[model samples]
Target: MVTLTPLEAELLAVAGSVPDPELPVLTLQELGVLRAVHVRDTDSVEVELTPTYTGCPAVEAMSTDIERALRDHGVREVTVRTVLIPAWSTDDISAEGRRKLREFGIAPPRAQRTAGPVGITLGPTRTAGQDPEPVRCPNCGSADTELLSRFSSTACKALRRCLDCREPFDHFKEL
Candidate 1:
């Protein structure tokens, strides 16, 4: 297993604490975008990050924020690298992140379901036993909600309306 030096650990802490520009309430680590931080040498540090989407506009801002955070923490040299292999997924988001998202008036992504290729079917092909799940309202804790739009304030989220509260909220879409 890889071990971190004291400086590396501290650097990681600072880098992880940097918040995402779009979702100010969530840190990069909470969003699972901050992948790894390593102390390259006595004075340089390297950080690995993954974007939520391929053309996400926040990636550059996140990288700048991470570098600034590390430098502020006394790391003279910092490098932020974006890795796309093993692409990021909603599953990468931590439990704490989900909780925070719920508390912040946003519904987290639904649990993942495995399925084969999706396309136009000739007729209703029924799987042995599977049912559609409802999206819950973040504000009222009600499962009665309807999708307003596939896209929300951000590309990663969808606009939804709570039938009970009549409040529009964002739902973090599942990949």
Candidate 2:
């Protein structure tokens, strides 16, 4: 981990503030994809961005947004690099991001244990009788939710319908 200069930190915040192209409600910072920002020299900077997953279609849009944001902040040259060495997980989502997801009619992913491989298979329900039994419905706070589809509006999410409220919502999958 390298120590960032004050300007670099400020620029990072600016770049991170850009909203996700797919999930507009959450910023890249909250999504934990905006990995780092480095100042190469005065008016020139490089940003490290990690995608939510490999081959993510939104990576280009995210990079473009970050570039525009940095340029708007008076950066003469901005380079956004995609890094995937340390793969992103649902655990990367911040608490604030989870809250925002829930508030936005989506169920946030349950915290994943780091010790073992996560095996969530789709059956009648999305969760395969995992420790976290019910995925829960974001609309009515019901634990009797059933999986509607393995893929939701986005590949990162699963579709579920609440038995209690009969409301369908997306659940950010634990990856």
Candidate 3:
């Protein structure tokens, strides 16, 4: 049996607490960014991640957060590895992550058939032919919404305003 030191275990726990810089409601794990963690024989910590979006600028901050969290837990050496294969998706977000996003006032992604592109789904009708509907407001659960901007505070989301509640909110746009 492999033995794990208390410090190593503690480091692992703290590493998971680091939240996504863009989506603060979700942790790296909940965002499905954290792929794995291992405590090396040399007492160094290894962290693997798949970026939520390719060319995401938040990755640098995420790596820094991981290193800081591990360092605080007494890990002197830390390696943050980025993996790209089997790309990350909104589907990868956990159920709890969806809940967290809702609580944070950002609508979670809508679920659809897994037939086509990452966010596209082909039904009997072609998705390309229809204009995408407005995403519901997470705060008030209203479908009466309008897109204020294609890009929100982050590139992954869009700025939307609800007609019923008259609230401006961010919606995680379908890719």
Candidate 4:
């Protein structure tokens, strides 16, 4: 791991504390978007951020928020850079972030899907050949759910309903 200077660490804490625009329940750090903080000088700093996916509009808002946060913390020259070389994944989310998402009535994203031996079902549906990973309901803890829409309030989330609780929720889709 790269060692952060004392000021960089402090500034990172401030930048990471900014709440996500789409999911207010999660902070930028919790969302795993705030990557690093580079202290250029006492008053200048640079931040690295990754988006949930390519073409996500939230990156602009996130950058603005990060700049504002750093400014409030006595930073004068703040630059929030968007980095996509290492794509953001749902697995980057912290355990606390997942729990918070569930508490906020949104199902947290699952881990990366494995390539070998996927569960398959013989059915008439388009996905009948191989069953996609089950997305459990955050409200009822039941895997019996159906996708209502490919997109929800946010592009990163999908709309779903729990078969047991009958409550609709947004699932933070895996990247």
* Residue lDDT tens for model 1, 85-137: 67888878889899999999999986676533223225322211222656778
Roughly what TM-score does model 4 have, to 2 decimal places? 0.87
The ten-residue window of minimal lDDT in model 1 covers: 122-131
Local accuracy of candidate 3 as per-residue lDDT tens digits, 1-175: 3465676556656877899887787887777777677787566888887887787899999999999988887778999999987777777778898899989999887665473476434432211224464467788887777767768887788787887898988877665
- For residue 103, give model 2's deviation from the true position in Å: 0.5
- Cα lDDT tens digits, model 4, 1-175, are 7998887888888999999998889999899998899988879998999988788998999999999988998999999899986777888899999999999989888776653332434543222223465777889888778778768988889898887888998999777
Candidates 1 and 2 compared: the better one by TM-score is 2
lDDT of 3: 0.77
Instruction: Candidate 4: list runs displaced more than 4 Å.
Output: 113-133
Which number leads on lDDT?
2
lDDT by residue (tens digit), candidate 2, 1-175: 8898899889989998999999999999999998889899888999999988786899999999999999999999999999986778889899999999999999999887773467855445534344355687889887877887778788899888888788889999888
Order by lDDT, highest first: 2, 4, 1, 3
Q: State the TM-score for model 3.
A: 0.78
Error of 1 at 55 (Å): 0.9
lDDT (Cα, 0-100) at 60 in candidate 4: 97
Tell how far residue 90 is off in model 1, in angstroms: 0.9
Clashing residue pairs, candidate 3?
Answer: none
